[model samples]
Target: MAKQSIAEIRKKEILSTFYEVAKVEGLENTSFAKIAQKLEIQPSLIVHYFKNRDELILALIQYNLDQYKQIFSIAHADDLSHQEHLNKVLDKLFSLDWNELYDDGVYYSCYTLIFRHPEIKGKFKDLHLELRSGLKTILEQCTKAGFLAIEDPATVAHQVYNLLDGTYYFVSMLDVKADQEKYLQQSKTLAKKLIGLH
Candidate 1:
């Protein structure tokens, strides 16, 4: 692997701090000074990397997309069959594990910008496309392995992705754990039905 440049390292550091601060204070409330204070660096250093708050926000959304991709990763275990691997992916998709990946408040706050910011909207579209593509690839593999019978992996992938998107958004608002689990299981069942699974 090639070594990371200083600029690359500093940018990631700034984005990571911004994410944490945003998670607590919200995207609208988080400022460059807050991020710089968290990093114990001068505000000018942050300006050196990001031209403006909008630029930093865009970079943070990309950072979020990178974090969201972790859900698709499967642990390579010799004992796990293709179907088992796909099952694991679906489980992760519907589970609260995503809550650990990023804050719902920060993500939804950024999502609202799609209406006002075309660039943010495009970045979000890319995030969705990449996620669906990953799911489609896994579904196709399962079909070829005879573990699934999806006729159109792309459509099924899109449906499942939508299911997860709606499920997570709704579940994020519930104050009760049981309610969240109930909806999550229901969504998973719906996803399995969509893919022709029992």
Candidate 2:
């Protein structure tokens, strides 16, 4: 595999640090100096790459969205059966750690911040719908293969996405007994019931 250039590596490091910091300190408190401190470098290094916090965050959003696409592609580009495919999708949807397909902290933070930033909202909306459409495609394929019972893949796709989002955002905070496997099983059971799977 071709190695990433020095510039590319630095950019990744900076973005990772930004996510870690924002996830901990709230995106409101994330600053170039804080990122620099986290990386043990001068703030100028970050400023040299990004003129301001908005620039850095915009770049991070772009970087993260691309990573999201890669994850989605890998998960769907497999030969899993209908049951196995639903499991794979939900495992990713609910932030399961075994596969580690998505970064929940960064993903949630971007979603939370979008409320105040319309431009970011637009970008994230596109990414969100793209993933939902991917799920719709999976459901349609699974149904064609006689693995599912959903007649309205479009509505089911949105509903499943909402379930995943709500469970992660709210249930994760309110439910003390939560674990990845439990959520995985719950998701499986729910999908099965939704589509009348035996």
Best by lDDT: 1
Number of colliding residue pairs in each model: 0, 0
TM-score of 1: 0.96
Which candidate number would show the highest TM-score if scored against the true structure? Answer: 1
- Which ranges of candidate 2 are over 4 A from the true structure? 1-3, 63-79, 91-109, 178-184
For each candidate, give its TM-score against the true structure.
Answer: 0.96, 0.76
Off by over 4 Å in 1: 77-79
lDDT of 1 by residue, 1-198 (tens): 999999999999999999999988989999999999999999999999999998998998898889989987777834688788888988888888866698888999999999999999999999999999999998998899898888899999999999899898899889898999889999999999998877
